[model samples]
Target: MNLYKLGKFLCTVIFYPLYRIKVIGKENIPKDGPVIICSNHISNFDPPVVGITSDRNIYFMAKEELFKNKFFGGILKRVHAFPIKRGMRDRNALRQGLNVLKENHALGLFPEGTRQKNGEVGKGLAGAGFFALRSEATIVPCAIIGPYQKFKPLKVVYGEPIDMTSFRQEKASAQVVTDRIMEEIRQLHKNHR
Candidate 1:
């Protein structure tokens, strides 16, 4: 019962029921070990939606601006959400993400970069792919269907893990690996729909 898990539990108890959330494939999540949970970004609430449904601490890469607010930042920190500069390659953010994986922690990365209102899956950033290749951690592809509005039961479908060990040995290009990861996520979305 660490602070992160506790906060996530509280969030699940409070918000999940109110939203009538229905999470599928909870068993798909690895019971333990370092892993990257890649998902699609729809709304601002998507992060918390995944967090509450997860049984482990999910280190989420949120935009740096979100940390500017003292009150909100405090809460975000409690739930293991960290800041990442939005456009361009932010080395600092990348290092932080790698450290989370090295420490045998779970991370949440939305490959689409930012939220898409059009509901189209966008290109994924190379950050998560790089981390997966370097750490040789498993990559879990997940999909979130529906909005986070009141009475709208958000659906989350978690897919089986994608092993990254081969990528690590072959030293795959970040773009190539990221594209593969994104394609898997897209497939998961299509299957769920």
Candidate 2:
């Protein structure tokens, strides 16, 4: 098995039982195609959880800081994560994301742009929206419910794909698709939790 799947398996063996993770609506994930899994970010733990949501190997757009440490950065790349400089339009990161979709791989993103430590959801950025509209990738909005407290019951609900084909003709902006994605994530939070 590849490092990504191997790491996932080890994480499942090690962390799953400890956190009592409950992954729901995984069936909502498309079995094949270029997919963008947009989710809420709360903690560092969210990345692993997001990767686990899809059966396929998912690439992540992580912050550039995560790659500063040589060892950890190497591990991140080995597991299919690329760095993005936050708060600016990092063209390199953008290209990396587009390439992932162009290759028809699953790309994971946090629409909020960064983590919300207060445990409350935040407004999403327009990045995910740009990706979906540009690549026409299937977007599966997901929510990570419950606290990340040790041994707590943390759940991940992968909701249905957000269809924007109808909105494409109206000259919808990236923010429009982003709002819809966040709405679906919030709905998952409401209905599942």
Candidate 3:
């Protein structure tokens, strides 16, 4: 097991029970192959919450700033978390993400790009859609509802996977594809909200 998997397992064992996490639709996750787990960004804790609840290991694209600290960078590296330069369209980050999906690993993407205090689903960036189309990966829509207060039960809902084969054939623009993916995430949150 990789460091991230080990760390995630340890954290899940230690914190999930204490936090009273309640994950729903976990089976909605694909059993194998590459998939893009698109979710709403509500808090800094969202990534780990979804990561632990997921049956498969998920590699997340974290902002480059998070790796500034040497200690934290080492830990993130173990979990397969990589840094992405926010804004200005970082092609290198996108390339790295594609490699992960090609390897049949789950890639976690927060369409909002950053944590939103209001929990509103902002316009999702084109990266997720682009990667899905490029890698021919399924897009799994996910929503994490409720504040992650200590000992409070949190809800995580994973929706059915959306196939991108059609989108690829249509030669859909990144914005169009991204909007479609974001709508799925929005609907998931709306239902649970």
Candidate 4:
């Protein structure tokens, strides 16, 4: 198996029983075709747990700073994580994301753009909406419920695929679309932290 799948399998075997990770609404994930999985950022544990929400491998746009450490960066690369420079368009990252969608693969994005330290779902940045509108791929909203304390129960809730037809209109903007996506995420986790 490839590194990504192997690592995911290993994590699943270990994390599920250990942490009592609970997953809901996984049926919302498209069984095939391109998809963008938009989730609220909560912990460093977010990617691994959320990636396993579906059996398909998820390619993520990790921040560039995380790639600065050669050893850790190499592992991230091996596991299908690409670096994106935050606070800018980063055209190369955008193109790479589009290409992933073009290939009918699953792409994972944390719309909050970074991990939330306040333990509350925050506003999403424009990146997720930009890709959603550009690729018109299936957008599935997600929320991670956790204080991330070890050996504690954790949950990843997946919401229904967002309807983009209206948002596809000529007047829609990326930031506005992002706001809608974030709202869905917030509702999903409102009962949690």
Give candidates' CA RMSD values in order: 1.8, 1.2, 1.4, 1.4
With candidate 2 superimposed using the best TM-score fit, by how many Å does residue 57's alpha carbon deviate from the native?
A: 0.7
* Descending-TM-score candidate ranking: 2, 4, 3, 1
lDDT of 3 by residue, 1-193 (tens): 7677678888799768877888888998988998889998888888888889998889999999989999998888777799999986998889999999989999999977878787677888888778877886888998887676788877888989887877899999887888988898888888887
Off by over 4 Å in 1: 1-3
Please say which candidate is ahead in TM-score: 2 or 3.
2
Q: What overall lDDT goes with each candidate model? A: 0.83, 0.88, 0.86, 0.89
Per-residue lDDT, model 2, residue 36, is 95
Best by lDDT: 4
- Highest TM-score among the candidates is held by which one? 2
lDDT of 4: 0.89
lDDT of 1 by residue, 1-193 (tens): 8777777677788777778888888888887888889888888878888888878678998898999999999888877888988888888888888888888899999988889887656788887788778785678888887766787677788888887777877899887788888888788778876
Give Cα distance to truth, residue 158, candidate 2, Å. 0.6
TM-score preference between candidates 1 and 4, better one: 4
Tell me the TM-score of model 1: 0.91
Tens digit of lDDT per residue, candidate 2, span 1-193? 8888899998888667877889898998888889999998888889888886569789999899999999999999999999999999999998999999999899999999888887666899989888988886899998998688789888889988888787676768989989999999988888877
Weakest lDDT window of 10 consecutive positions for candidate 1: 145-154
* Model 1 RMSD in angstroms: 1.8
Residue pairs with backbone atoms closer than 3 Å in model 2 (clashes): none
